[model samples]
Target chain A: MRAGDEEISVSSTSGSRPTSKDAVINLDHGDPTMYESFWKRMGHRGDITIAGWQGISYFSDVTNLCWFLEPEFDHEIRRLHRLVGNAVADGHFVVVGTGSTQLFQAALYALSPPDTPHPLSVVSAAPYYSSYPAVTDYLRSGLYRWAGDASAFKGNIYIELVCSPNNPDGSIREAVLKSENGTIIHDLAYYWPQYTPITHAEDHDIMLFTVSKTTGHAGSRLGWALVKDKEVAKRMIKFVELNSIGVSKDSQFRAAKILKAISDGYELPNPKNKYKLFDFGHLLMSVRWKRLREAVKVSGIFSLPEFQSSYCTFTGKRTETYPAFAWLKCEKEGVEDCENFLRSHKILSRNGKHFGAARKFVRISMLERDETFELFIERLSSLT
Target chain B: MRAGDEEISVSSTSGSRPTSKDAVINLDHGDPTMYESFWKRMGHRGDITIAGWQGISYFSDVTNLCWFLEPEFDHEIRRLHRLVGNAVADGHFVVVGTGSTQLFQAALYALSPPDTPHPLSVVSAAPYYSSYPAVTDYLRSGLYRWAGDASAFKGNIYIELVCSPNNPDGSIREAVLKSENGTIIHDLAYYWPQYTPITHAEDHDIMLFTVSKTTGHAGSRLGWALVKDKEVAKRMIKFVELNSIGVSKDSQFRAAKILKAISDGYELPNPKNKYKLFDFGHLLMSVRWKRLREAVKVSGIFSLPEFQSSYCTFTGKRTETYPAFAWLKCEKEGVEDCENFLRSHKILSRNGKHFGAARKFVRISMLERDETFELFIERLSSLT
Candidate 1:
């Protein structure tokens, strides 16, 4: 807390040191910049316009941008609705958000009934979206307890957040969420083709997606949810209103624009041409996965199970699932030791202990291009 | 929720047509852009090396920038930090956020303690920030209640979300927040010179600010808070970690870069000669306010009292302060009638009834520029 100190103290209580968790490769988080082409394709800076719902775009107002942007933005929004709606069905409502993270929070708020009980028991799978427990626990504090297993929770309400092609161990099967009843919420953050090709069941409970992963523009922060039940969507919107007020109109507009690109086949890279394919998010994810697997093999500190067993079904059989990350489980005796070794070398990776997994595993985000990945592989090899 | 509908039905229930308030302005939310800038700011695109703090400063990479971008982009972050930090004190930790709106949520989450008899009771002046009740109700539901008066109930924890120059009503007084055995979460969202002078009372409380109001870059979605108490600060960090997975690193870096523009005085309309002493943010805010006030006078639909009396210390023997909003107690027949009058002309203003105001008034934001205000005034005049 000293003012003159060079490094700001990141901890409240005196601890050994802030963990090198932040420095780790961060494959733990599903940021899509790992693929070079996906990164290059999305890294353009300019205000994009969309068609308006009424007639003219709301942002077309050159000076203040209220009059023109709506009409232009609407065209993009309608296109996105068609694309995302086709992915699911048209009967449901699509509520855009800052990210699926906001939607996830909103789902919890919406599902929770009026003054029910102290510490409401919220249950999720043993291995779930790593943030679910954290976000739930953080908000619910004493108001809710993160009851691990859904079946055991004999509480008033059972809320489960399921992430497909899940984080850390990328094992997402529909059967995994079978036990979720009462109120089940799914965080389909990585369900995009970049991670896995198998989309949600058209009439599944509730699903969420973000343009950041699908388009490799994490900065846009636009995500939406397809909710089968109208009441649930309403409550979620209310929660959003309470949380941050609402998602940014500009970000929403941009997301709608990007969605148009994907539907037009202009955003995604073609898998037929490796280089050209890399320009597409799904294709880029594939390239990063290959590089990551190579790095993991070279590192020798961990062993990845067969892709099939991992249940990471990206583009079809034999086609790797989820390019932006390679969730490598460390079979070593001490994952904490491996984590330390990597951090000391400045190659940051997310520790697996947080995701309800054995400490001996690490989630490495494949964010580096070939050169950086090769350098990382070389450094990783030295660890063994 | 038609597949190709430009405007989706925002509400699930069959109700009146949606207005700005009904639809959710989300001005209350933050982290506006998720991470779309990651690729665009950096020249090479995907996974570019951010020189400091991992892809932070704009100059580290700015080839894909807009025409308005400055040439000296490299020192953007440090400059922003200086600008934001200087706005407050040198010792305070101004961690840039997705937006000040996110910080508000974080502040609430941080203050809500575990093991409470009832949910945490939040108290603010009547006609306080509109988000206070909505945010508390959304998360804690029955656990937390908005105490209009300080004597309503006795709770172990009391968080005062002080939105000075307040939101909706634009009211601020030193006595408004009496930190007697309670935590004061001061939302200094509009305490800049344009709204009011910096009211610094070192009694010990948490304060928040966002670049959105100050810089008119709501799309950037960046804000930060300064907390005197370390425990409170740590909890806020945890809340952020769980919620949005930490503000986008790219946004933070961009924010840091913009911070420099504020500090180096380069952000002003004329940094060198004419507008040397003017802070760009203050100038912009003032310009907008001037136009808004003029429009209000010309139309006479509502009156905008002096900004200081609404939220902060008022001048000339009256000490009142409110954020950049005019909380007008409608002299008209019904609140709904006034709302309809404004809405008929496509003008949007928040109703103060939601903020617990005594009278039927509307809270109009002065964030719009002069020209937009003029058009809105013309429309309002026509309606009248």
Candidate 2:
């Protein structure tokens, strides 16, 4: 086994932290292990029991256009979105995918015109998610090609990806490059009340969200896309069909159960069974952010992006954004590569170059277990 | 709701078949609902219990190159393969996929040279898997393009797909095209004792297998690739990483449990435990095939492919093949399109044209539930 990965798994699962000099705190990727305790507290409420004979057929509900989607999952998804008031799922067609990663590619495939002479231009902001380019261009698909940052892209017809409360840096985003022929796909993966304020119900033409970021079920690899246009939604479904046949039904079952638990925590009549997921998420994130900010201040080596407080429609309170990642800028005179600087100290962070940003900025995950987070803060505090 | 789809679901679930003319017998898709009874027989032994907190992390075993693969799954996959003697798993890297569908595309990506000036040509023999051309050409990738009918292909360099105990017709196959620079990928999805004779253990450069065909867990959407070359395996893993980040860990967990149960049936010392999956599968398939052949003979309208008995190494007996599908041909003097003729009679089957064959041939699923299969036989028997 990867020794580093073993240490990370151990740190997340158990309360004990290794005192060895080589326990590298892996924050390079967003693993979402921080939510383990919340689910543990949930006990059997979070348990997903699947019978062997159930879900044996490939067909779930064939009456719907998105027939691959389980009815329970569809019901739970719509219920959760309506309860949170983040996005409208009432009139939209829901296409399930392996994950938002697959859905992103599906969105690209759906939006890109197949008969175009040249590949359709795909762009996002400079500090865009690293995967947009990597996933799009890896296959060198003739349907679409990456065209770098959206702000600098000059195109008449293009597919622009708008990741709101964007990755690397949590900033409210909109279509930077607009044209009548241009189409926009909103990656609302991090738009939940815990990550950002649910200011209003988003009414986008095409929106993508995932269970990985929402419920911290990264291993589930489940996601859905909401498309206003029927033709686009059908095309996305075709893409999923052509890509992986369909999403995993077991994951869908588990996701449905988890989502039902979350919704029931808020709306259930039983007073003794109260366990609000968002409240737990919000408080935990706030505490972690506070600790991280203080550690950064004490070290005097790095600076974090400041977020403004806004009134949340769901929580009915004013709160600052607590992004899943920390966009830390290395303020030191010669620290060009912040990722390297952090890696040197046994704290792994993603290089900004990967996100099409300057090397001075590095993205660190704020979602790790307390033991790992505490160790990270301890390591950062002594860096000066 | 799709009325036809709903009816099919009901037929698979309930024992009753609708007498209404509108209830279409959907043998068009291989839903694998026949195995539901086997899993039902398994009872709680087939149950998969997943804690909400467990498998939240993206990392499973980072120590391995195929980092996203769960350790339990890897172990169980090797154990099962060894138990069956279907393919050589030792000294090969195992890469997990959403399904064999995703793994097929990943195999294409791995075989193709990304820097090639022109798209790599992908070819397969006639009556190939219907999805071969559809999935390969859907996106029209510049990395590779579908070049049909490998037997007729004249090329200096190409990638050939070899699906043994082939899809439309159950014929054991080997690569028909060969060249110095050519690559071969084996789709051994149906190379099990139940579907065909286990003549020998398969040891190829690249081999693909799926839970859908093996254990009949179509809804799980889990598959694995055994690759001999390190670089090729790495590329395949990268394609999966880009395609969907990774396969569903919940599905992986369930697959592992199912596989463990399967192996335990054969090798476990407990005499009380006597459920052998292959033995169950072989007997069920044989009875279905026997009934289908008798019905076809009595009707004198349709003809199915004839098979030669072979000595099975696993069973240690001469056994006739029991294919999952029946490639039936219309023997009527005037009928050219068998699919259309079947559709008119409320029996849905896949048109042979989809598999790059003549219109007179139609592929019918033989693995439906007992009620559906009986109805199908009754309809076939009633035909003049």
Candidate 3:
């Protein structure tokens, strides 16, 4: 049950060298590893030292509409939003969650009427985040049911989870189904300057964001939602309270510290500081995306969807899609299952079928550590 | 919006003096404040300092059945179990959760079949934890429904949640329903030596524990369940994965540090260190209970349930009831609602009706800070 045991088992089963086709290298999980060097550069500045008695109270600030939120967390969230200039913070209530995952479920719960004649349909576009359906339908809640593909969905009283800078293909997206009955939850988890251009200060009715994708601190398990409607925010808070009482204050405290550090790095007066989290993150991701595209071009056996460059206010420059994941479509006629093809080459990938896409497509994580990504690129290059 | 604002509001609403009967002091929340001194004594030993890059991996150890767990958390859980000797850790799998609240839901999700003809009945004894029904029926999931009072429940296929040293009224309890179709979840949240006598090592099929009651770290929002069945544990893990992906690693890390400090204090060769967490907690709670009883004795308007002294293996001494909450019954004439009576004096206590008890009774949390609890006692004594 130790982490060492897992490493030993994987190494033993897959062999040490990359020459073995079946050697295991998990590139399927969307863990953000691009910030490792950036954080390492920041050193103890990003470290969180919590006192034993810190946040001992179950309730953080009782007056906060979202009472469970740590005050520091509330401040840091607003500060981060202000720095990013991606999401509007004013006149919005922030509901903290374990992650965007919990927030997604909470949003679904909040949007749907408890006594609806039929379960409200929850639809995201095809090639959506795989967990959307699983999370929505797991309990088979009477409140809501996963109704796939918003583009094709013809329904009233529905929840459309718009994951802009979408998961699988990293496409900049908008709501396809527009109706008063449709509640759009804009999951702006990847709308950070590192991933895509901040078109404008998004003022969606309900918007979701997570530190996991923003700073590659997935294990922190911190996310928040900005809701225009107080009632919706209250319902979302109630859902969290019933689900887990509240998000971890320890996590919230750490997130606040990390977020502050990120903001400080961004606001560093000296341009030569080299520890600008946003700049570091953007550079790292941009390089990774460039290297991946070049590798795909050299391989000639896989293709990626071309992304249009757009001006980003945060960086004040035009940027291309530097997604946390690379959705690859196998160009070879024989490779029906792109996942299996990648698996054969010692690369573990999430099949596009899980994302409600064709079997010819596979999602490879672009968030792996440098050494792992380099090896993946080498192995991918050999496939040609 | 801020903690300072909340403090100001409370002070503004109720003058800062204890002489006034209409001075507010919230004694409704069972936030264990006894451990604050103990943790403060431990100082940096109990403090958690997590590096920026620590726990960046979404998956900690794949070889571990609970993939989301930090190895240190697993180790700390076992160590704490060993130190307490109230719960058996051997031949069990540990599933970390957001809290015992989330774990409670997870256990129900794991126990109930997804394709059952009817939702599995979830039952708890009368005067149970109020959150049970609220959490279970929040979504009105097709998988389970809250069936009140296991004592009256006649159903065969059901999930019974047994909260030992039960909430509201502190009483040692077991499963009231003994059907083979029932799956029992032992919520040993307040089963620590400070609250109750740890007479024997509990070897339930599924047992729950939380730092909230154990270490007074409710804001940490961390809990662990020990399950004897691997399949059940796996299913519970799946539930957590769908619920919030996983518990917070930041909280897990902090819990591990705090638990380690607790264990260290117990295992210390030098008993003169005066930092033993359990001994400190027991002493504080014992003093509080004694003071409360004496105060109530003078007031003569309220009554507390008499608890028998029991031989505790942890302390190797007979211990009286030092429950986290005081279940008080108003003996005053024409006092139909004890909560309302207390609220009239600006002392906030949970109404007994919330716990499915008589309107004459109320639950006052003895776990508040010393100043607040003292103020509550002053208010109660004034009512006489």
Candidate 4:
């Protein structure tokens, strides 16, 4: 595969020829494959075998508002919370979803009252996750409307979305607009110790998390929200029930088994247990970020944000940002559209404009496999 | 368990008491547990074991609009359609979803133009799936509104939903109101040979199918749509992309494996192959429906819809109606609400009012486990 790249001819017009050899390096989606080796090391322990008759019934448990959640999933989620010490799961009700995307929509549906004379404004800080506006406004719901940039918003009743360890830039964020009439939904998808320093447990009224960024199980399409209010949780559950009936139990069961393995690995007594998911993830991400920074330094055509070191409660030490994405700003001449510039070099990246940011910047996924990252670095270094 | 049921005293006002000894029989949800014994017969052939590194990448295929769909899923769907000879798949673009629920919403979203002067009215016949209105109006989306009873609906432009082998009842249905402006979405969720006879291949613009009702894997939460138009298919794909970023690949993979098993069982040379999913499902459902009819006959207070026999292509014989749900009408004096009457007797059912039908009728599920169905029959017979 490495030699095939050199043999294939590159087309300047189309960026890259659709040959078997020089396929375009896709860094557009944040698919976490850095934990591949870690998961592979666990072997059958991390594997999931679902029987034909398993989860034959649609209802998981009638008593719980999130009746779609498997009991093992509920247990694993609580265990992971206790181990990470990131979220307060005791009082909060957990609502499962297809992914954090569904939960994000569900949160909007739950937060906004249907009888509101005007649709409740949903706002987030600039350079937000690209899907926020798209998901919120696509349906054109009368209950809520996307009001971009919370900093400039002056709504009486609004829903504030806070994506901590923000998607594009990877900066730890909070609600910019403070108001008594506002309800906040914290998207803690990238709040794990591997991505950034965990300052303290987030006890927000509503918090969102996904197995996609956490355990690199994006294909599983599993996510959950921790909601403080029972009514809100019930509403979210109703939204899911009406949306997809419920989250897939097969995925939930798989997630539970994988999460259990991760929790067990984290609790291993030996410091050098090697099976510890967090330690493995942290080390891999730290190394990848270091290599990426070094490569970018050599290129001198691009610049990355300088993230400050912070104390992490989980690691009991200071650590720098190890984000899943590299927010790259092209400093070269005639590179106004950084995404197009990267595309010309056989690389695909998400445009910063999509995230309500400047066209000079682009978001590249650092969660790809090591081989893809290496090729990306090689292609990027040539731009110097 | 039988002895415990006999020992517990039933409450008239609140229905069944929440005690460890007496558990309520949930006949409300159409969870297909009738295929449990059939699946058990297949043993490991029906089991799905996913490795840790399997489906690690978020993107399944780049060319497809729904990039998260596993290729095996596409293949299995085509195979199943060909085997059943129900829906056209050759020229149609297949869009995978979380379930038919998401697909239904997607169809609505895709059919309605966002810039239209008013929301497009979405309608279905009376006794439609109970979730239609709830799912449509829950978000209060201005793109579309739920207009009940397609027969009485008058609209210039609208999307009509047609659930063949209609839910809450066993009657084979067709669109009552025909208009060129009206786009039809055929939900073939219960059109399998086990539930109803497949008269001919349904060549609708948009046809929906789910693994939940077809294979009794309700918890997997996987569904697909056969869309004839490329633009509409793309729009539906966009809905799913914005909804959950695509369906779960883990569930899709499992669905593919199970679907392959079913197809393989069907294609076996020997007609006596007990592992054939359709045959097994048919036999189980036929016997169950017969027993249920006998029990209802004994209980003269209840009456069931008399369905005409139809020639089944799959079975190569005429078959009576063996529906996933038994739409029962209470004819006893003082029984105004059939669901309430059944609830008072310790049987939980879905009220016909929920399906936009009269309160005198209640929908009882025929998809429960053998033990539960037997208990339901015994209790129903005692009510006579």
Candidate 5:
């Protein structure tokens, strides 16, 4: 609830302390490049070779509703979900997408009634993912329109996008508006054990997961949506079909291999199984959070939200959340625009106004390279 | 143009095909699996491997507007276009997409004026590509709406989609709606040497090309648009960024390799280079069309459009167009619906009405595997 005022001594990492004063530090977007070192340590276990003739066909499995989805990709997705115990993939239809972003749009399209006299209202709580409003309105879709602030919304029939371990601000969330006619889409991109506790196996009407956040393969551009309803799943597939014919099988093939490697690190009966993706991610996130907290304490100008500890079934431990981003609030006198203040110091951060929050709040990515994070900490510590 | 009723004698191929009678021939979609054999012959030339830590970041080149586009892929694209003398890629911004389908939607978004009081009307000449209206209106976008048949459209301020070597019907076409205020997106997906004669280098304001049609990698789900206008290209890139963040780097990496292999077949100074993709495609298409014509002549029930020969700049030879899809019209009495007529005999074809054409005509994909095409020809030969 407040900035950590007490300084705690800790052993320094092998990486050199940041001293660069001229390098531009951009913590605007959650790029997730921090996981690159772990992956490099994992090495060729995740490497995949795709021949010219293999996966050349348009259809992967013609019998499935999502015919474009690679069978191996689907298998690995379900396997990963089962391994983590974060989401229930059993008896649910899996629809693969270009990314969670595309699947989000498809969810909105599927949930909205086509025969409605007006565009279906789409709402999320205040400080929602920055993209929710921008993406919803960018296309100017008549099928659905963004109705900001779900708790303030009065409509009964609306689509709610609940980003649990939410973006900009990391908080486990559910639909604030209570209505039977309302549809909810759970964006569980950050619900993995690394960022938050696997409190329960989520069995929502619709859930979206992305490799970008889970395995830090942002360039792979692969995501999947698990839908409980057959019709809604089919409609989402239809949207993808009409959008890109289907996803790239090359990504699917590579992603399947990458995910298989991750799952194998835990599931396989091996002596040295230390390359577990979640374990690596969790350790990195914890360290980053600790470093950020120390930097904030030294700066004496910013405050961070305190998260409650929860028991994680996957990790078999009670731990506080380690979000991919830091929602920092500028507490300095007359520092109303925290993002602008940071920009003046050669630090780029996303203004909280984009997420429908106060000008004093700014979202700083904690998923950048180690050197960049060190630079950010050094810059922050120098601010006061 | 009318169907050629004359008996065309063709030398029989070595393969003992046309024996499968119970097989269900689904030519409803252009799967483009026929190019598999060509790639197989090329073998290992198009293979690509990605390391666990490579391409982990979301950005490929932050300096470019299309930041997600791999510089290697862009270079290969320009190299291929120059080698083939198809589209003018120089001095143009290259925007990679999920497929040409995604780029088409992006074009629609870019071309449509967002502030217009009414949705910008989108029209293509009939019978246009079947998905034009479906994709344009599926989202019910307020930015643009599908206005059927470009030739019949009354509005001067509209967007025109001109598919050269047009889908369903293989006619080299230009925009029918010629207005100073009108925007045209030329879908040159089938304008390659194998599908059609490339008479001149295309220099359209917006041109879309896909590997699915050009290189027979439909599963790759990769395409690029060459845009003359900088602002228009930027808007299209924005649409893609919002739709999927960007195209998959896996696909881009593999597609670049595949395209490079194709170009290398001709460019590499080797005497025994026999794995030319276009040559293979052209030969197969010629044989398929010959067999199809012969089968139709024997069936005496279906008609096909007659095409004129043109000098190809790339091939340096005069040849009639070999379209990826056959526009087959039922000549039999009482057969008002050709798609339905074909469906009864276990042969699948897309209904012509979907393309704003007569129900008597259907579009049969010419890009399916050899076995399927052989079965289709046999089925057609036995239909009457």
Candidate 6:
């Protein structure tokens, strides 16, 4: 058990106050629940149906679900094949995964040598996905050094994880030369319809997607990576089967179900909308961008840049696509910690420093509903 | 990209046969969707709101639902703490997973030393989880050695994954003392109210629980391990966060919602079910046990000595409590390869060999709803 709670005190300048007494206007973390009133407006509530005794036999049920899913989604497979075929038009094979994060770890596992010493050179562009440095440090026992800038990224580096439409800064597709010296794994977590049209399908050796973002059900835990090389995909899939106990067969079915829902909508259209099927099957591109623009205007503490200036669009034109995240260069004065300032006030924004950026950039999620947006704006305004 | 498609032709066994033409009874796999009629009854048609967007975004209105998830449940830190606490009580702390399989690989990562010239040795009791060997082999690059018996388990051994209520044979808890040489991680996926009392609060150092079993909502992609050691839990949690880009925040909320549902039913009293709650709960348990017994009696392909010799005890019965899984020791005369035989017959039972067991055992799930159980019995009878 816990060896007698040794009172360990942690002090953070942004949030070191006694949490119990301190009323936190939390902007530091990305919990969607911060927008409670809005969730109630949508169909979500607090009522959960217990599988009851039915839950007792879920193990067997799960095994069976996997069996049913493999065949029923043959159309899905074909659809994925068609999607991959589009990727193959660029040349890639879609590697299905529990989440693209699994693929990220797998890529590291597959590429990194076991004997690699501490300070293995790992590099990424400034303001990339925050998790890149976090994951690398985590895997290497907090010993993995974050190699300098992408421009200066050289030497016998072990691996590099880069995210487009980057986590905190919302940087989209940038250029990269072949990293023959180090293995390069592109984490295109937001490369779906939200950030951009699914272009450059065959550009990278690895690309990842999940049901969470594409379907707006991040809880589904279904994500996959498209690997140009079959060997990598095979390794990644095998890695997944070993992790999280094969991504809950039930999860895959749900993903397939959700995907089926998307496809079904496409095949059987809603006449009221004047379309034969739901043109936007399971994706959330246009709506999110609108919300992002709205949030930026309301929350004055954030510094907004022109399109693509924040790694969003390649050009400044308002397009039909962009991811759900708006990376804001938070004005932290000389503190140089944008993520910290927001967290102190109870807003959970991601710190850009984790993504190799020197400045304090924070990633604000546009996933909240209207009331939440208002609350976030109010809270943000007060903070500034 | 996939190499020249023209050059890759499959043998007949591996070739894509027409679904209708290629059926040996598929008992080897565990899928409950085979009985879709029940799911429709359960109101699992599809999410009406999710039908709108075709992409997932941070600001997607998906979380704003009135279906019964509370806003408080979305706190990731608190929820993740609970998830970690649950895992620790089960005896292992390594969250090295996006899935349990990911943990399996993480165990290897933790256990396997880089300088060892020979492949690391992995050992488990017979009739283990099937994915063990498959995942282990996949990670070893065809070099890891599987020391078959518990007695021979020895040095240079990186890790050992053990499962209680041994998958195919239903051996409740292995005598772990005999196999304590290596870092022992237990896959207690089935250790729930079925085999273990909900009151069996005696926590272990590590264990695993997936929503698939606890709530029958496998699609949630939520699972956790209970690791007691703080250090290990920290590492595993880090591994998980890095691998899957942090578990689907949405899935975590849904799972917590379901968990509260399960806990609520047992903890509170409702007017609709005075004694009805207790009675209904027990009845559900009986239903599962009855189904397992009936399937065995009618099919006669497998023997379930545990069920035949089980008692209705509340606690400390030294018996497995997970009612959903029926680990069977296969005794059929010609069926040496349990996996192949079950697959050929269209009954998808997991082969026991992967679980470090003799090939005579297979893990069969008891999660089929009542009607499907009846149908499965008929299919089994036909096999006889």
Per-residue lDDT over A1-384 for candidate 3, one digit per residue giving the tens place of the 0 to 100 score: 112111211212221223344457777678776567788878798898899987887777777878788899899889989988999999999999999999998999898896786889999899898778888888878899988888789867689988889998899989988888688999999998888888789999999999889888888888999999999998898788778877898888888888988888777675776777777777888888888888898999999988899998888888777888899999997889998888777688878877878989988888877777778887788786
Residue A335 lDDT (model 1): 49
Q: Taking the tens digit of each residue's C-alpha lDDT, what string does model 2 give over A235-291?
A: 898788778877899999999999999999999875764478888888989999999
lDDT of 3 by residue, B1-384 (tens): 112111212112221223444557767667776567667877688887889877776776777888888899899899988888899999999999999999999999999997887899999999888777777887878999988888889868899988989997899999888888788999999999988889999999999999899889998899999999999998898888878878899998888888888887778675586767778778888898888898899899999999999999888999887889999999999899998898787787777777767889988888877777777777666677
DockQ of 5: 0.46
Q: Which of candidates 1 and 5 reaches a greater TM-score?
A: 5
lDDT of 6 at A1: 7
The residue-level lDDT of candidate 2 at B56 comes to 89
List, residue by residue over B1-384, the lDDT tens digit for candidate 4: 112111112122111222332456767778777767888888898899998777666667765655667899999999999999877888888899998999999999999986786889989899888878777777778899888888788776778888989997877889887888888889999999888888888888899999989998888899999999988998898788889987898888889989999998878665669678887778888898898889888989999988999898878899877889999999999889998899787788888887878989988888877878888888888786
Quote the TM-score that chain A achieves in each candidate.
Answer: 0.74, 0.94, 0.94, 0.93, 0.94, 0.69
Which candidate's DockQ is highest? 2
Q: Is the docking of candidate 6 incorrect, acceptable, medium or high quality?
A: incorrect
lDDT of each: 0.50, 0.86, 0.83, 0.83, 0.86, 0.47
Report the C-alpha displacement of residue A286, candidate 1, in angstroms.
5.7
**TM-score (0 to 1) of chain B for each candidate:** 0.68, 0.94, 0.94, 0.93, 0.94, 0.67
Clashing pairs in 3: none
Error of 3 at A167 (Å): 0.8
lDDT (Cα, tens digit) per residue for candidate 6, span A141-222: 3224456466666565556666775655555545453545667777665554445544444367776655555545554446
What lDDT tens digits, residue by residue, belong to model 4 across residues A275-300? Answer: 78788888888888888888888899
Q: What ranking emerges by lDDT with the best candidate at the front?
A: 5, 2, 4, 3, 1, 6
Expressed as tens digits, the lDDT of each residue in B281-307 for candidate 6 is: 345556666666676677677776554
Residue-by-residue lDDT tens digits, candidate 2, B15-94: 22335544677787777888888999887877899998989877777677787899999999999889888899999999
lDDT of 5 at A291: 88
Better of 3 and 6 by TM-score: 3
Ten contiguous residues minimizing lDDT sum, candidate 5 chain B: B1-10
**How is the predicted docking of candidate 4 categorized under the CAPRI scheme?**
acceptable
Task: Kindly provide the TM-score of model 5 when superposed on the true structure, using C-alpha atoms.
Answer: 0.95
Give per-model TM-scores: 0.69, 0.95, 0.94, 0.93, 0.95, 0.61
Worst 10 residues of 1 chain B by lDDT: B51-60
List where candidate 4 sits over 4 angstroms from the true fold: A1-23, A269-272, B1-23, B269-272
